[model samples]
Target chain A: MNGGLRHILLALLLLTGLNPAHAAEPIKIGSFLSVTGPASFLGDPELKTLQMVVDEVNARGGVLGRPVQLIHYDTGGNASDALRYVKRLIRRDRVDLIVGGTTTGDTLAVIPEVEREGVPLISLAGAIEIIEPVKKWVFKVAHTDRMAAAKIYEDLNRRGLTRVALITGDGGFDKSGREQLRQLAPEYGIQIVADESYGNRDTDITTQLTKIRASDAQALINFGFGQAPAIVTRNVAQLGIDLPLYQSHGVASQTFIDLAGPAAEGVRLPAAALVVAEQLPDDDPQKPVLLSYKNRYEAQHGPVSTFGGHAYDGIMIALAAVERAGGTDKAKVRDEIEKTQSFVGTSGIFNMTPEDHMGLSLDAFKMVEVREGVWTLVENAD
Target chain B: MLEQLFQFLVTGITVGSLYALVGLGFALIYNASDVVNFAQGEFVMLGAMTAISLVAVGFPLPLAAVAAILITIGVGLALERFAIEPSLGASVVTTIIITIGAAIFLRGVALLIWGKDFHALPAFSGDAPIHLGGATLLPQSLWVMGATVLLVVLVRAFLNKTLLGKALLACSVNRAAAQLVGINVRVMLRLAYGLSAGLGAIAGILIAPITFSSYEAGIMLGLKGFCAAIIGGMGNPMGAVAGGLLLGVLEALGAGLISSGYKDAITFLFVLMVLFFEPTGLFGHKSADRV
Candidate 1:
């Protein structure tokens, strides 16, 4: 009986080895995203974009003549789930690279794992901490919150609106945005006249807005994510606060405009050029890439968001590095990614270096105003 | 400075009216059955979300609002019949636990139906702001306040004047005694649930324009309404309304005049002080219990 089992096992092994001519070894790319939870708005678009680009790449003869495989897990917005999935990606799937981490919390949770496992990670989150104290194997494609702050400050400075009132939500993203805006105010010759914060789940913010209306702020800056910013927009309109209102990139999606309704008109925010892709000047380097992505995505999905733009850049950057390194050698890809320069992407033209992993600058952001319920590029503010 | 205070008051009163409406629902249910209905907020959420969905599907505003309230009442009655009635003889803590479980289940169902996106209802009136003495007010604020006052009076009259209302109050005082007096205790419980659900639905429809609504929207509103009921002596409807207004005004004034960062902290601290000074609540009367 033992001899018969051994002969059968040897015959099975030989049969599997004989079928190797099906295709070249696939390049496995893993991801963990918050695709069905509170952060699903961010992750859903990101997953779609990644899937779309991977299909398009494979259709174009695949990357490095091998089909690209995306092995993804839905984390449901839990940081612990993200860490577990990242470990599984590295140890089980044996993916060459990872291109996800839909939130700052999830990205930060998996940094140590990616570093230890010697797999490169391309995060799609927007936090300064993700790249400031740079991890060796970790990189992000989204603009830092600090860059968003600086871009807003630049617009305010150009418009001669020096005194700013700040209304913030007490969530992690909003708190970080408020801090960046506050810390960068002095550099742009701006003064924060009033500072008010509300709870993340607080239904009413009229009290805070009343105080802001009572202040002598020349411009108002509201930093928050999710539904709070839309509520703030409505309250600002209701309170009749006439100052120029500025929001962070946190509320850059089309959903914000829909939720805020007409009150969203005239509100300005620093956002990726992907938002106003159709309106971008023809000479703009990002217009072609943005339009192509916007068209491709909107054809499959109903609407295109900047979050999806981040993922598109992430996979493209990863593939570019793989090409430059001649293989998915982790260390070589890391070196090539660090040496990247002038790579035009949906978010911006990236110029990576050892010192600056998130290579996009403030110019990657465009100060766009809501005009008649649509994004109008604010040329003078730039 | 005075204008700022007035603005804060306007904002506070608008916000308070919502809390009062929700608190009144809590008071109504607690009075009818000694069990606090933790799913009260889900009623509010279901009302607004259903109304919004109805309007999206071609129903007129008034029709949608009425239909949404009826649907919410049905849900409340169903909850009582299916979940609470089966466990009628359970301890108060167990009943409360059941209601909490029901609340979570309702929230999960809402998530499945409406997803996690925040949805808004158009204002009943125009979205124009009325400027008065260097402050501004949305027309919807007036609607909220006016409707709240009317509902408070109506609810008070219902409890004091109607025979059915008296039956509900009789249930609150002593369930065994109420059952002995030829009252259908189960029917009274069902009535309490339905009435409170209607009240919660109205509150949701009124505030949807101002606050927006989501599957999880009821969590904070419910907590604040519970605080209102607790601060105003848990079983007293009028007291709960008063407690809600007081909480709203204090929160607004504190955030406006003091530190905005400490707004929630200040409100909870005040609630704690009230509880410390009077264990029976500020408006609660001393009662002797016989074993």
Candidate 2:
């Protein structure tokens, strides 16, 4: 081999060897989320928030006098990518803590690897499947789909709509949706009429809509993400179907409006307390925290905040726990997180327990309506 | 029950027309040049977005739609000349992979240029849901179905009747022979690609009113159309149409009778079963070797 090339190769190896020892000097945290993919809409916001919180903590004299170093990967919302990035973070990056990934499928897929590695893994998505088997190292910051559904049912019970038809995509979000809504329907005096489900990639749902139109339902509840909800909105409008559409929190974005046009107006749904804090006045209790986070995030990144709030909450709690631990010991940090009590978060007051990795409950669901391209709070606290 | 059945059929036919149009474009390219242009979906996306942009800028419907189709045709010819001809005589799978890579590149370019916002192509007719015999159908959907049927007939006539079309088919069958027969096979290849892109652009424009336009919307639509082509065989125009319509019906039935959750699964399963059991396809000729 040439002398210059040989020297370069040796230097690279030496740098690689010195990198991990370098990583340990700074309290390292890893983040993996869908910076690109179907769930990128959710992951992008979370990533923005994660970077924001990391910056904030570092500026405030990071935990234990060591600034937190964040290593991140884009999982692309693929389970295989999650496994790959998990391996990369643990084996290569040598991160002390791991946070993120915004989809149920990816989070659940990586549970086995997280356990095998024994690194503290906190999920940004809650599919109910992630925390149930209870791996020693796994914790989740997002509320489970079941809890979200339960909250919706309780809130809608008082609403005059008795029969509701569903239009949902056949995806991971739809799975928990069917289970939770089906079981919770009778409890709320709501009957599911003419429910329709389309594929995750299906572009049209006219057949489902026609059936939905013929039904005696007074309202439509959509459970899906992105284009699915938007497609439904446009289709319903094009078909001249006038039923009020209540969408899953997954549809909380301008993406729907961009796709659905004027059809997006007046749609009702449940969302995180923070994202729609615009509906709450300046004097509202939740306004200050949400606005501050939103402003800081927009200034740092752009105007997108979904998993950003969850991630911000996740990092804050994780850092708080690390401080309570007085060190980066995994168990002590976990213990401190478990004892989180009424900790005001972008979503709600999170009070996590050892038994429950997800601190917030169904009570976190806040009813909101889209009016003139803006999401407004609908007062329905069941 | 009857209402649900009606709804499912309307949904199936509207979406099926789009798949058929896209599959027909694939068939045209495959038949003429023996190349599967997997970037057919990008043409569709480009058409939709182009039309949407023009409409957003207050252009007339006919002008925007025509511009979209012409632009796509230009893109197709450009791609065939630069990418396909250079890699001519390559293996089928290699061409397919190249096209897939091209699809990714096109998607990235679209994102970089237009951003990742979903946009709707305004319906030519005003938004009024028309009820036809207990079934509600959108006006845009009627236009799509009408356009699809028209394209099918137009394609059949053009391929069977036109001298250029005959020359193109002759090239597909025997390029060297066609060249000896005083046919410019290179021009035929360009013609095939341009026509394919034109047809896909039409589908993109026709369906944009309902499906809306986005940079990445073409990915799933392309996959579904490709699956339809698989069911129909790669090169047969009739098979492509039949396969598209059949898959649409199957998806509708799956959505209506069975769990709506398994619609795509059923369509994929149908494709798999056909490939496994009847590799020649429902109506396609043995254009290539199978095994």
Put down candidate 2 lDDT per residue, B240-260, tens digits, no spaces. Answer: 888888988888888777877
Q: Which clashing pairs does model 1 show?
A: none
Which lDDT value does model 2 have at A372? 86
Clash pairs of candidate 2?
A45-A308, A46-A307, A46-A308, A207-B7
Candidate 1's C-alpha runs over 4 A off are A1-26, A36-38, A51-69, A73-81, A323-327, A339-341, B285-291
Task: Name the top lDDT candidate.
Answer: 1
Model 2 Cα displacement at A256 (Å)? 1.6
Per residue, candidate 1 scores C-alpha lDDT tens digits across A116-176 of 8889899999898898798899999999889989998888878878999999998778888
Chain B TM-score for the candidates in order: 0.97, 0.95
Worst 10 residues of 1 chain A by lDDT: A4-13
lDDT of 2 by residue, A1-382 (tens): 3566445534544655654344325778988898788787788788878877888888886766568989999998898989899899989998877888788888887888878877778888968778886667788877677776766665566666678887777777876887778888887787887777877667777767766777788888888886778878877876678887788887776667667777788887778877687767677665677888888888866665556788988888888887666556666676787788877778777877777777777667687877888778888533
Cα lDDT of model 1 overall?
A: 0.88
- Model 2 spans with C-alpha error above 4 angstroms: A1-24, A55-65, A112-118, A132-136, A160-163, A186-195, A212-218, A237-243, B1-4, B53-67, B114-117, B227-239, B258-262, B265-291
